[model samples]
Target: MLVISYDLEVFTPPCSPGALTFSAIARLQGNIAPALPYLNAVLPNAVYNPGAPALVWKDGRRHVVFHADHLAVSNLEDRNAAVEQVERLVRLVNETWQERGQIEPSYAVRQRPTPMMLYKLLPGTNCRECGQATCWNFALKLGAGQVTVADCRPLADPIYADRRAQLLASVIEDQFV
Candidate 1:
């Protein structure tokens, strides 16, 4: 069983043509070029494929990347293993951060904007617990950054594992991860 893994939240922004995310920000500006190789190695299963540039912000740095997608994966199953992998990957990128003379390298510290959250609420059961009437409507709200992930109720349902998974993919973490 795939007991645990990083839970990812994927979403698109309203003003942009592609998606906006937080993870991409950690790659940093000058560090982005060198960091890609490390990210590519760790995220072997997850591909940036057609993901467009995203806006990533931390403390005082705002990374404006034009093409990339934000990915959210499970951090539950085998957290020790997952955290270890992330740590190794971070070390690789931190090397790049050091070359730039940055005092600190921030990783996973900002909230990413994902629009896909609205529909993630959909049990596909069309259960109209939310006034929106449809999950798609909720998704639209989420993409606009108007609706929050907590507003999604069906996510708490045990039967909505898949739905919860989808919801997980559309939220941005609020921490200096």
Candidate 2:
């Protein structure tokens, strides 16, 4: 296992002081740099930086980042949640490492689609079917990985098939589509 132990540091998010959400960083004992490319290949919508040798992803409102020998996560309910999240991430890394043989390593950098770009492809009608007030709001969440393309129900309508195709091809995560 690439990650067997770590020291945890939990704190309130600096962006929102005293906010209920917290963030945590785990100082790992082993470096998982060698497994990053494999992770980049297998993890849908993961942003991998060859220069930083790191991989980052957003699972709903939570942001997760993996470095050579460390892992950081944000948007936790509390320190206890942070601990569980970090341990879960460690298990993910270890599992990915073990499954490396079945995956192709990806060194190519793929840029995340911008909110404006995503908005252009969205149905202009403020249908609120997705529960968001506007299509633009949906675009913002989609760009940030907080929501998936499937959540925008209008996109599935046959009338918007072309735009939907474009979105699935460009902005949507590989796993979701």
Candidate 3:
């Protein structure tokens, strides 16, 4: 076991009986995936999007939400123990989240129309190589933090090297920071 420990504070949408959220949180830890057996079994159409654990700052509330595929720990205590469990779970969740998150951009230059810029920088080959008809469309989704730059096979060239780097850096910053 690690010398230091942590706690996470998680806020989920709404639960149905024993249903947990896709993502979870503990105070010391931010993003940990939740275990949802009831929902997974009951709602087959439920989105099993294993979202990245992130430290979200919104409405003056900093929450760490993780997109979970399943929950493993069944020893979460009510109050104090919950705190310790949250912290430990948070650490583990962060490790897992970091392992599966968006690609990082090369530069830290913030831009509002990033998706558009990415689209413009895209090759626009639409050769179905990137699994999309238009690179612009893909860029739009990428900018909205929906898709990754690697999706564009054409852009995966030496010509778009610099731009690709920048785009990846931006993505990583958003998801990890």
Candidate 4:
């Protein structure tokens, strides 16, 4: 296992000390550089920085950064949740390491879809069917991984088929971070 154990430190958000939610950093025992590319290949929306030897991805609303010697996660519910997330990441690293040979490492940089870019493709009907007030709001959530393209029901209309396909290609296909 690339990561057998780690020292976990949980703390309130530095920018908002009074915030109820917390963040955690797991100081890994060993480096997991070898798994970075493998992870980059498998994890959608993962941004791999070969120069930094780090990979950053998202789990729901939580942001996870896998460094050579450590893993940091933010927007956690509690300490236990943080530990669970850390363990999950450790497993991912080990699994990726074991399957590295079969995986083609990706060093190419990928840019996430900007909200404006996403908004441009949306139907712009201000349809509240997506639980959002407007297409722009939906785009914001989509960029944040908080909502899915499927949530925008208007996109399913045949009239928007072309735009929908474009959105799928640029965002949905890479929105699993």
Candidate 5:
């Protein structure tokens, strides 16, 4: 296993003091630099930096960073949640390491789409079908990896087919693929 042992540290974000959210770091006993490219290949929407030997990914609403010596996760609910997330990440690393031969490792880096870029492609109808206040808000969430292009219901309309296609091709992760 890539991460058979680790020391966990969980705390509130220093920048967001008193915030309800938590962040955690797992100091691994071994280096995981070699597994990053494999992780980048398997994780859609992941941002990998080969120079830094780090891989950044979004797991649901949480932000996760995998480095050579440690794993960091932020925007968690509580200590228990942080622990669970770290455990899950460790398992993922081990599994990915074991299955590395079956997967193609990728060294290409991907940039997350900007909010403005996503907003321009949105329908801009201010529809509440996505449960957000405005299309701009949805764009912001989409850029942050908190929401998917599919959440914008208006994009499903035939009239917005081209825009939808553009979003899928340019920025949105292809979950179906």
Candidate 6:
């Protein structure tokens, strides 16, 4: 396994003193730089920087960063959640390393679409079916990785097939695929 041991540190973010969410960092015993490109290839919407030898990804509402020596996860609920997330990340690294041969490593940096860019591709109905106040709000959440394209019910309409196709192809990550 690439990551067999780690030291976990969990704490509330200094920038948000009153916030309830926590963040955690796993100081790994092994260098995970070699597995980054493989992770970049498998994790949809992941941003990889070969120069920094780091990979950034969004797991639901959480922000995760994988460095050569450490893995950091933010926006966790509690200490247990933090620990669980770190463990999950370590497993992900080890699994990716083991399966590297089956996966094609990606070194190219991919930029995530901006909120405005995603908004243009949306149906723009402002229907609030997605529980957001507006289409722009949904777009912002989508771009931030807080919501998926499927959350927008209007996009399921036959009339919006083309726009849905464009959004999924360009902005949204198809996790099922």
Query: Which residue ranges in model 4 land beyond 4 Å of their true spot?
Result: 111-177
Counted clashes in each candidate structure: 29, 0, 23, 0, 0, 0
lDDT computed for candidate 1: 0.38
- Model 6, residue 58: distance off in Å is 0.5
| TM-scores for every predicted model | 0.40, 0.63, 0.36, 0.62, 0.64, 0.64
Instruction: Go through the candidates in order and give each one's C-alpha lDDT.
Output: 0.38, 0.78, 0.42, 0.77, 0.81, 0.80
How far is 10's C-alpha from truth in model 6 (Å)? 0.2
> Could you tell me the lDDT of residue 7 within candidate 4?
91
Error of 1 at 65 (Å): 14
lDDT by residue (tens digit), candidate 6, 18-57: 7688988899999999999999999987878777667878
* Residue-wise C-alpha lDDT for candidate 1, range 71-148, written one tens digit per residue: 222222343443443444344445544454433322222234344544545665556665567777777776776665
Kindly list the per-residue Cα lDDT of model 2 for residues 72-101, writing each as its tens digit.
886689989998999888888899999988
Q: What are the per-model C-alpha RMSD values against the true structure?
A: 13.3, 8.8, 16.3, 8.8, 9.0, 8.7
TM-score (C-alpha) between model 4 and the true structure? 0.62
Expressed as tens digits, the lDDT of each residue in 47-117 for candidate 3 is: 22223322221111111222332222221334454455445544554443344334221211123456667
Off by over 4 Å in 6: 111-177
lDDT of 5 by residue, 1-177 (tens): 878799999998664568688889899999999999999999987878787677888777676888899888876999999998899999999999999999999999866667888899999989699999999999888877777776787786878967775565444222211
**Inter-residue clash pairs, candidate 6:** none
Clashing pairs in 2: none
